[model samples]
Target chain A: MSGFLDILYFIVPISIAYAAPLIFTAIGGVFSERSGVINIGLEGLMVMGAFVGIVFNLFFVDTFGDWTPWVSILVAMLVSAIFSLMHAVASISFRADQVVSGVAINLLGIAIALFSVKMIYGKGQTDFIQEKIPRFNIPFLQDIPVIGPMFFKSVYGSSILAVAIAILAWFIIFKTPFGLRLRSVGEHPMAADTMGIKVNRIRYIAVIISGGLAGMGGAVYAQTMTNDFGHATINGQGFMALAAMIFGKWHPIGAMGAALFFGFAQALAISSSGIPFMQNVPSVFLYILPYALTIIALAGFIGKANGPKALGDPYIKGSR
Target chain B: MSNRLINVLVPVISIILGLLVGAVVMLVSGYDPIAGYIALWNGIFGDSYAIGETIRQISPYILAGLAVAFAFRTGLFNIGVEGQLIVGWFAAAYVGMAFELPKIIHLPLALLAAAAAGAIWGLIPGLLKATLKVHEVIVTIMMNYIALHLVNALIKVVAKGGFKTDKIQDTASLRSDFLSELTDFSTLHYGIFVALFMVFIMWFILERMKLGYELKSVGFNENAAQYAGMSVKKNIVMAMVISGAFAGLGGAMEALGTFGNMSTRAGFTGIGFDGIAVALLGANTPLGVVFGASLFGSLKYGANNMPNAANIPIEIVSIVIALIIFFVACGYIIRVGLQRIGKNKEAK
Candidate 1:
């Protein structure tokens, strides 16, 4: 009975662990698109972050020992932020087709990361880490019945941080003056410019923050969940996050809710055996669920979801 | 004179700016940008083998670029080229495995199957857009995922314990050992010839045919074309189908000529997405596509090879490509810079 209880305890926290990466990434997506730059390159940025995270963690684990995960997190943020600058320079400064530029960034990120992995390991996969993100039991709250064990015991601590960050993101996006200025820039850049808000600076800040958050998400994923980097590590997570952002109608809390739903779907896919004939369905269906759902969500079946008014439109100073 | 100079100089300036940014990144990482660039240059063009390999790599891009450029000309973003390529590959490979005939008959049959499959794959999004009034971008992106999963599942089911199809029959295979022999066993194949032929055909169709003109007109302004008695929906559908056909041919060549067999694990090679870059860089022209494909192909091939010779990561090349596209897309900076350079030259 105790063993069964323990097993039950793992379900929600593990699901939350899976949800962390998507939550952070989707929040990142919200920041970038809200500033009118569509970051299709999130996948690429995540991949780059994953690779550099693992590479840094691999080297620093012996030196920093248990703190390796923290170091890796910082490394990922820097790499991903640097990578996002390419998009900013292209889409914001250069005023390129945001979609095409995003595609280019995706290709660039994948190619570089894959090529480097090939060079380091002499193959596609990276070396497994000795020190990964350590799992922890939350101090007093872990003793609570049923839900406590699932949420606080044997859970990846990074997921808890993700939830806190999501709330913080909401505060930044809605409650603050800076957030208002940023939203104003996204809704009407010309009007914001006339009101003396630095449109370019806000965009730069948004894209950079987007990249940093996404980079941290990738690092968290590698260190906590997979504990290693490989060619397919980032896979479709970035796109899934994008879908979540859209499905949530670009709201941070809404995006988090969508991400958690996706995480539950993923967890359910593994745990539910009596889902009728779905037991016989291939795993690829689960793999494609978020993307498929995104399409359905975008089809207007979910009602008219609003996007940032200036989304995908390059800001011209005087243009109406 | 200034405009003429700027047209030639913009791409050059983009490339230079891209390289400069790449250099800073390299420097930050404690690597010599000069050494890395030289190695990349040598890897891409140092020898006959490298040149042949680059050309071979460019072959698929030529077709994919044309596919994208065609759709773009009609003002339709056929993002489903990735899916079209996958289905076309499966169809062509299935035909190649199923048939046994004289090489002359079998090859054309296989190629036709690929083209038809691509067109049909393309038609789904077209039909949806035409009938349901859905956006092509969303449909096409969805189709990419669907095609990827479907192909993977199909491969697992059909392989019957194998990961790939039975080796394609000799008659259906587009082996290029003859061309390889002429090039001293370099990777270059007869696919280059095929790509060139397709380019010529694309040019002839777009520039000389009334159907092509109608398609272009529809793309430029659907309402105007509708007023001129052109069927906007039909042209949009046809444009997607034709564009998908080109992408399908790209898959056929890659499978038959390069790999000589189809693996289920190989779905969309991402060349379709890259085709967007090629089309943009090429200005959506058939001949321009060849040059764009060659440049990007070399970058891809070179970037792949760079990590081996230099410590720099291959992703640096992608960063450079993105920067180049950004500069091209903006055009404003390049335009101002060129005018300044021209004014200075006149002063001199």
Candidate 2:
């Protein structure tokens, strides 16, 4: 029992760090998809965010020092919003296939990042980031016995911000006029249009917002998990976030919970050797456990779940 | 414009625009676009060796493209082709090593093993899509990561941390010394013939067969096909299985002909993802996929040498590919532009 407590102490903090990015990106998916535009380009958008965030941090770290991470997140978000406009125009305005457009963005995002790195350094890689986001514990709460040390110790600001943002997102989606219009567009665009709501306009904004949040998610992963931006920095974290969104039934709070579950699985996989008995499991099995779980989880959602009714269909005016 | 002209012109225009944007990116980065393109051309077509390499590269692309195109014709999106291809790749390699049969028997047997393996992998998602109505796009993407990691684990177990497996027996190998000599010592093999044969099969099935007509009708309208007494569920599963067979052939070509060995991959080969673009570019036809696959193959083959020759990033080739696909997706915009020009001509 003592041994198990020690393992939990290590796993809890690490899982939250992993969960922060997934939660943010999953929330983005909920927004775009709930607005009737499925943003499969989250992976690409996240990569861009990771790239810009690190590059911006490197450029300004000397001048801004420790405060660079927060500013870089904002920069990445802005850049990502602009980058996703291409998807918005292609899918919504030019009437392109949403999946195809998303794939295009994915390809472009990675290529552009790689090409820029090559152009800047005349090589396939960039320099590693030296300054990282600082971890902190709550002041007096740190003295509180078991719950404090397990949860609040060595915490990332990004994780706390993620929970807050999720709460804010839940409120915006469930309790606000803007979210009502957004849901209406996703459910029935013609019905929403007749009621003086602009479907295309809402979709464009929703996609941009999704892009911005996913970018920040990428930034968070780079800052906390990898501490560097490279080809492999983001890996498949964005797709995992998408799986969380689906698993959560497109609800913000639900997605956050799903993200936490995936993060715990990931933390378990990486740290299994440190815990007794788990060392017997093959490392390869652990590596694949999260992805296999994601597939099973999505399959589980099949009978009960329904995505936005107008999802994947472009809105056309006066075409009842 | 005639339908045939539009069909040809759309891809041509898309390619030109893709190249133009690639050139602009190069210029903005202070590189000479003309020099880079010249290097690209020379890298792919300058010598018999380059030509052979390009054709060698084209082999798997053709089959993968067909896999995607075939599924599209059945109104099913089969993004799981990557997973199927990897499973087939490993299956072919496994059979080649495990068996000790006659040359003729072993080669065909390995290829069959690959196709069967891919077909089974594809069947899972197809059943889910048909019965549960779960989207293939999400299912396949998740499956892809699972396939990669599973293969990685298996390869480690089989090879005992070797990271790469040994070359297959000579009987299972597709490499032909005669074909390589004919191409002046390049990696070209008999896989090209096999790929072309598959294309011919695709064309014959879709254009000439009874079952092909039913598949096409089903693809065009699922409800209509159902009302007309066709089994949508059966057709969906069949389409995915057949599509997986083609992607499996692509994997076999890579395992037997090109590499002749299996190695742990860091990520997907990107051949399957690129196949989606190839299918769209080909207008989802076998003959069109041939054209798209060839173009893509040449670009990829050339990209390997572009960085050394012109001081340009090899990623430019992929950027060009993405741009081409984007332009194809936005084909309507170009069509509208052309229609406006035609109207002005009429006004004049």
Candidate 3:
């Protein structure tokens, strides 16, 4: 019985690590979508950030060694922000179709990152990181029974950060004037514009913020979870985050809940192999649980999840 | 008169600019960009073999691009082409493995099954969009994942411990090795002929058929189309079915002619998504899709050779393609450059 409990303990922490990257990204989607820019490029941006973060961490660790994670995380955020500026230029400035422009950004991001990584590394993947984040047991609290180990003892620093960021994201999305304006733009940009808000500028800010957070998510995944970078490392995580965002009904807290649920499903899928009854079930089915859940969520099985009214519609000045 | 010439020349000029950018990247990386481009050109068009490879690559693009282009003409975004392609691939492959019959019947039967499979895959999004007013983009994106996992599950069940299916029967297979004997084993098959036929059929259907007119009218404006007595819902669903059928045929070509079996590789083949770029670049016309697919195929085939010859990564080709798409989509940037050129000419 304790052995079963031990397995459960192992599953929760590892699952949370996998969920951390997605939580940040889903929150990023919340910011972008709330501001009415449908950022399909979130996937591409996360991929870019994953590559840059790992590469930066590699070099920084080669030199500074100890301060590598902080340096690499900052560099990843900066790179993602710079990368997202292209989407801003295309969608916000040029007034192109937000979805199409986002797709272009995604294509450009992946192409550029993969091309450069191949040029520098001589392959499509990067060398594994020598230094990786290890499990940290919190002082005093780790000694508690049952829930304590699952919450703090077995959890990664990045997982803790994801939860903290979720709270901060909730505060920002609901408690701030900027958040109100962002939601106003997404819900009705023309109304916000008439109210003297700089709609496009706000949208740009939202997109950039999204990119930065997603970059951090990528960095955390690299530094904490995988400790390596490859062309396929960020495969569909961004899309999964998008699904989570939709599943959670586009709210930050809701998205975090959805992310955790997805993370648990993934963890359960993998960990279930150890359970006697589920031993025969193929593990691949769990790999697709999040996506399956997304369809179910969208099909009205989860009730009506309304996106922002002005989502995906490009804003044109002086148009009705 | 010359100014009008420049307007037509701009897309060509953009292509040149994209190539030059690719060239500059190659030079910076210590490879001869000119040699790389030359090698790419040769690999795609230099000999009968290379040309056949190019055509082989373009076969699916022609169909997938048509899939996307057809939907676009109906004012629908069939982002589910990837899903449709997978279902079509599995359908064709399953039929190929399940039956043994005369070539006269098996080949056409497999092809038709592939088309019907794609059509069924496409119908889900069409129904949702037409009835529930759900966005096709989201539904299509979701369907891609569904198709991937569902097929993967099916493959696991039917493949009997192997990741791939058994080799398709000779009756079901569409090999061109015999034709290759005449053309020095160029690897081109009857698929190219089929693809070309599709181009003609698509052109005829979109131009001559009343249903096609309704689809186009709906694309332009649903209100106007409905006022013109066209059923928007029916056309939307029909457009998706036709698009799905095209993608299905594309998958059949790949399964029967190329891979000869169904297997998972890296998640999903990007060919269907790449069709989006091709259709957009080709301006979504049948002839244009062929041209765009050929261009893209040439670049991809060349990129594979570049790593061996120039020591440059194959991913740069994707970069070049992306850049070209970016430049073309930002038509205002080109117009601005053209305007400045005209002003300079006037001053002279």
**What tens digits encode model 2's per-residue C-alpha lDDT throughout B65-123?**
99999999999888878888898898898888778999999999999998898888778
> Which tens-of-lDDT digit does each residue in A1-320 have in candidate 2?
88888888889999899999999999999999999888888998999999998888889999888889998889998999899999999989988888888889888888899889888877666677887777889788877888798888879988988999899999999899999998999999999999999889999999999999999998888888777766777778888899889888899998999899888888988898888889888766666666666566667743465789999999988776
Q: Which stretches of candidate 1 lie over 4 Å from their true place?
A: A1-14, A62-65, A114-125, A138-146, A149-152, A265-278, B1-5, B16-52, B124-139, B186-188, B222-232, B264-268, B299-323, B343-348
Least well predicted 10-residue stretch by lDDT in candidate 1 chain A: A269-278
True contacts kept of each: 0.49, 0.75, 0.41
Q: Which residue pairs in model 2 clash with each other? A: none
lDDT tens digits, residues B261-294, model 1? 6776533487888787778778788987988898
Off by over 4 Å in 2: A300-303
Each candidate's iRMS in angstroms? 3.4, 1.4, 2.1
Ranking by TM-score: 2, 3, 1
Better of 1 and 2 by TM-score: 2
In terms of DockQ, the best-performing candidate is 2
Better of 2 and 3 by lDDT: 2
Off by over 4 Å in 3: A1-4, A280-284, B1-14, B332-348
